[model samples]
Target chain A: MQGLAHQLIAGIATGGIYASVALALVMIYQSTHHLNFAQGEMATFSTYIALTLIQAGLPYWVAFLATLVISFGIGVFIERIMLRPMQNASVLANVGVFIGLLLVFRNAMGWIFDYTIKAFPTPFDTGTPLFGGLVSGHELGSTAVTLVVLGLVYVFFRFTKLGLGMRAAAFNASSSRLVGIRVGWMLALGWGLAAAIGAIAGIMIAPVVFLEPNMMLGILLYAFAGALLGGIDNPGGAVLGGFLVGIIENLGGAYLVGTELKLTLALGIIICVLLVRPTGLFGRVVQSRV
Target chain B: MDAGRDRIGTGIALPAAGAAERSAARPLRLLGLLGLVAVAAVLPPLFASSYQLFQLTLALIFAIAILGLNIVTGFNGQISLGHGAFYAVGAYATAIMMSHFDLPWWETLPVSALICAAFGFGIGFPALRLGGLYLALTTFSLAVAVPQILKYKGVEDWTGGVQGVFISKPDAPEGLGLDADQFLYLVVLAFAVAIFLLAHNLLHSRIGRAMRAIRDHSIAAEAMGMDIARIKTRTFALSAGITGLAGALSAIAIEFVAPDSFSVELSITLFVGLVVGGVGSIVGPLFGGVFAVFVPNLAESISRAAPGVIYGVILIFFLYLLPQGFAGFPQRIRALLRRRPEG
Candidate 1:
């Protein structure tokens, strides 16, 4: 029982990170209908920036906030410069560009930061165990940070006028244009927000995974499984799905396939969800007229 | 058949060659082809070292792999970021057959092709339901997971685990009066020629028309009574089989198979080749293969990070500026020349 509880706590902590990244994915898919294949790489770049900032002695929270802003600007810049021209292009073109960005970001990070893995500093104290050793201090603190970010995002979308305008633009670009919303800017904002959220996820998970160019690849896969599971289009459902996938990954890794096959387990979940319930647990069936 | 041709004309119509012009060019075209073949056959042995021959053989192998990718992504409109998975499967199948079963290397190709085709068919079934982005996502995950799966303990005996499997390289026949490197080069060239011809024939056939029809517009094709699911699944199988054959060839050429060699990077490299060579063009894979094999070495010579940087920049630039790739360059030039005279 104790072991199961420990696993569950650990899973939730990791799942919280996945949930954040999944939300970021959903945000982009909601607007552009294009999966940002470079999302993971972008987040990794942001985390590296955070590491650089801290190393230069900018306090933790200050560095974190600055990284988020810089990441947002980078996201918007990429959309405006690279993706905007390909808006009317084929699926292959869009995918090809995303892949290009992925390679550029991954290799650029390797070049700049070097491939050696570095230990990331966590804001939370690592010396203490919380809740009778069920969870570590970093796990608890990171989960709290993730939840706060998720809540802020939910509130922004639910309450803010800018968020409402972004939603309207995504839901119907033509209609939103008639109603005087800048549809193009909304898409860029969506990219920025997604990038920022991804930054949070990257930073939160960095303590556990360590900081490296390839750190987010497996987590990205897990996040994909989560987003797909909750429905690619549903933000709330994706978050729930992300947490569920985290729990499943932890338990499955522990009891079923062992640690070596955890990635395979994530792949299986993605395929199964896509095959059995592609719209996901909470997704609406989208219809198109020929 | 005429109607199908007309439909394809509406899709990506090449400038129609008049019968008289075609006849006039036929012998010249054949002579050119023969000249090219003769050069391919003799140039490596006469002017190049054994190492150069090996590199040329690897380039031919990559061309085969890129051609397979083009069949699905370029012609059939299915984005497979995981063709490396098929390539890996093909390699393993060949390795296991040669090392475990003590089978001759030539015999392993067909078995590798069959296994990869079946694997492709299986993956294709689910693909029938998934659209572009979803399929890309699924395949990407498959690519990411493949290395891990190869290292799993369950299949370690057959796979040889992380250390990987190796087989002895085949030598030339005694009567051929050729060394091992030259023989392997010729053997690979022969296979490359045969496969390229087969692909050319396949893409120009009725089934090829059907595949293109589906790619251009699935709904219209379905209305025309085409079995969308079956054609797609079979196309996937065919594509996978071709790539797997390339993998088998690569295994023989390199004399080894390791999980690390078939990383997602290989799939991306093949994709880069397809884009650079020109998608949906019969001759493009040759250019793509050369780019795939040679460009990285060129980039690496500059710096450690140069390859990925070069590949990324070139990929984006080509997508934006030369979407038709190198294979389409001649037609593009012709169009430009004709337009300049008119303007």
Candidate 2:
């Protein structure tokens, strides 16, 4: 029973991070219909920047804020420079470009920061029993922040004019353009927001685990599973899908299998789900244009 | 009267009439392809240095694997990120069969391919519709999960886990005066050429046209009377089968097959090669295979500051600057050199 609760708690915490990342992935998929293969790598690079700043004796909050702004700018720049130019290209070419970006960011990080694992300090209280020492409050704090981020995204997409414009652009770019909405800016905005979200995810995740050039590879997989499981189009679906995956993975690892086979089992489940429910758990069934 | 040569000239219009004309005009296309094969056939003797020959050998084997990727992602328009798992499956099966059952090399090759094809068929049953990110995730998970599952405790006898198992030397005939490097390259070359030609034919065949159609627009293709699901699933299996053959040969060449050798990194390399070498073209995989083999080697030699970083950077640059890939370089270069080139 104790193990079950522990696994549940851990799953939710990790799942929060996955959901947060999945939220960004969902946003990008909605706006561009192209998956940003470099999302994790971008997050990783920004997180490293934050780590470098914090290590230089800057206050944690200041560094965090600075990192957010810089990440936003970087995202916008990437959109303008890389994606925008390839926007009207063929699907394969666009995908190839992003895959290229993934390589660039990953390699840049490896070259600049070094590939060896390094510890990044967390803003939340560390080495202290914040939650009466029963469980690590760090994870709890992470979940709280993820929830807050999710809420902000919800509010942004639901109520704001910019959000409305972005949504319109996402649904149909040509129609959005006809309505005088700047579909181009909306895409840039979406990319920028996604980048910021990924940055926050990276900073939050780094302290919980060791930081390396490929640190996000595993999480990216989990988030990919989450986005696909939840229905790639819906933000809320991504969150739900993420938690579901986390819980299943943790519980499976604890009770049915050892840690080694946990991910493999999760993969099996995803494949099975795909076979049975191609539209995913939350995705709307899309009819082919037959 | 029926037994006569019967002036059988009473034929209907051939669907592939244009194909014959295209092939005749592009005689150099076949020549260029043969030129490549001749390069491989002569490599062992020309490059007596084992190191360089081994690299060529590895590249040719990987060409087979990359060719598999091209069929799915390049031709069929499905992105698979877990092919390394299939490669590993073939490798482990070969290693185990040769060491334990003492299976002959000839026997293990087909067995390895069948096992991998089975895995691919199994994965493709559900994953064909995932598309883009979902497909990427499913395959990525398979790639990551395979190694971990194999690394688990109970599989030690078959897998050797961290220690890894090595295979027996290949049974090369005595008359073939080729050294191990030369011998292995020749063996791999034979299958690689056969597979390449098979894929070439399949790509241009009726089934190939159906796959490309399905990839471009499944709905329209289905409306056009193509079975989308069947084509997609079969394409995945066919692709995996070729990759399995590569894995089997690679197992022999290196004489060692382990989980580490078949990491997601190798799969990424395969993808990078496909994209940069030009995906849909028959020659693209060959170009990609060579790039995958040579670029990293060149990078490591030029600088040791994280060779993969260099490879990744170059891959991204190529994706951005040259999406048509190296195979399209002649046209691109000609276009650049002159304002236009006559077709």
Best-fitting candidate, scored by TM-score: 1
Superposed by TM-score, candidate 1 places the C-alpha of residue B341 at a distance from the truth, in angstroms, of: 1.7
Worst 10 residues of 2 chain B by lDDT: B1-10
Every model's TM-score: 0.97, 0.91
Q: What is every candidate's C-alpha DockQ against the true complex, given to 2 decimals?
A: 0.79, 0.62
- In model 2, residue pairs whose N, Cα or C atoms come closer than 3 Å (at least 3 residues apart or on different chains), thus clashing, are A100-B316
Per lDDT, the best of the predicted structures is 1
lDDT value, residue B130 of candidate 1: 64
Ten consecutive residues with minimal summed lDDT in candidate 2 chain A? Answer: A126-135
Candidate 1: tens digits of C-alpha lDDT, residues A1-290:
99999999899999999999999989989888888888999999999999999999999999999999999999999999999999999989999999899889999998899999999999998887778888999999999999999999999999999999999998999999999999999999999999999999999999999999999999999999999999999999999999999999999998899999998988899889977998999999999887
lDDT of 2 by residue, A100-167 (tens): 67767887787788889998887676577654544576888888888888899889989999899999
Query: Interface RMSD value for candidate 1, one decimal?
Result: 1.0
Quote the TM-score that chain A achieves in each candidate. Answer: 0.99, 0.94
Clash counts for the predictions, in order: 0, 1
Candidate 1 Cα misplacement greater than 4 A, ranges: B1-20
